[model samples]
Target: AQTVTQSQPEMSVQEAETVTLSCTYDTSENNYYLFWYKQPPSRQMILVIRQEAYKQQNATENRFSVNFQKAAKSFSLKISDSQLGDTAMYFCAFTGRGSTLGRLYFGRGTQLTVWP
Candidate 1:
């Protein structure tokens, strides 16, 4: 089984500010995919960004970016220009092949609040 961990249960940031959410995962597979998903009040899991295990470069999407440290098994999300619309439950997810195929493992999620 793949495991993901989000250390912070809650976080808040002012408008136009920046914030980083920490995440770590444990997996035995060498080839896999890591993702940061944002689920707003609407409860739709939006794919913020993704990183492939074999890639050395981190992934970024517009205002969202990821700090992926393969050796340390760390993948953290950094949100630039925090907006009130960004407030939501952010989840760190993992998917791989073999025994863990066809399943996505998710962290408990960190509730992020963007204050005006």
Candidate 2:
């Protein structure tokens, strides 16, 4: 079984500032995918960023980026110039070889608050 851990339960950041959320996981699978998802008050799980285990370079989209350490099994998300919309419950997730199942093992999540 794969396990994802988010050490911080909550994090606060000022708008326009940068905030990094930490996540670590334990898995035996050689091939897999890591993801950071944001769930807002609407109860929708939105994809923030994703990192492929086989890729050496980290993944980034706009202001969102990830620090992926394949060897250490650490994948952290960095939000640059945080915005109010960034306030949400962030989850770290993993999917093994059977991605067709679309089954994801997720972390408890970290509640992020972007204060103005």
Candidate 3:
């Protein structure tokens, strides 16, 4: 049973600034995938970033990046140059590689609000 945890219930950041959301997970499997999904007011889940357990280097997408610590079972999302559109609920998710595809276990989520 893999479980994701986001300690921060809510976070606010000023526009054009940077914000980092913390996430941790507990998984016994050696190989798995971690993801950060953002759901705006529209309620659509969008992939922010992803990191593979085998990879040591973090993943980066535009202004979004991840701090992946495999040994600690921690994966955090860093949003740089935050924008008003970035305001949403960010969820940390995890899934196993085999037999359980597309079934993601998500955290309670951190509500992020970007102020202008």
Local distance difference test values of all predictions, in order:
0.94, 0.94, 0.94
As a whole number from 0 to 100, the lDDT of residue 35 in candidate 1 is 92
Q: Give the 10-residue window scoring lowest on summed lDDT in candidate 1.
A: 95-104
lDDT of 2 by residue, 1-116 (tens): 67899999999999999999999999888889999999999999999889999999999999999999998999999999999999999999999886424779999999999999
RMSD of 3: 1.2
Q: Which model, 1 or 3, shows the larger TM-score?
A: 1
Q: Which stretches of candidate 3 lie over 4 Å from their true place?
A: 98-102
Please give, for residues 24-104, the per-residue lDDT of candidate 1 as tens digits: 999889888999999999999998899999999998899999999998999999999999999999999999876788789
Error of 3 at 10 (Å): 0.3
Structural similarity to truth (TM-score) of each candidate: 0.97, 0.95, 0.95
Q: Which stretches of candidate 1 lie over 4 Å from their true place?
A: none
Model 1: lDDT of residue 62: 94
Give the per-residue Cα lDDT of candidate 3 at 50: 92
Which parts of model 2 are misplaced by more than 4 Å?
A: 98-101
Instruction: Indicate the worst ten consecutive residues by lDDT in candidate 2.
Output: 95-104
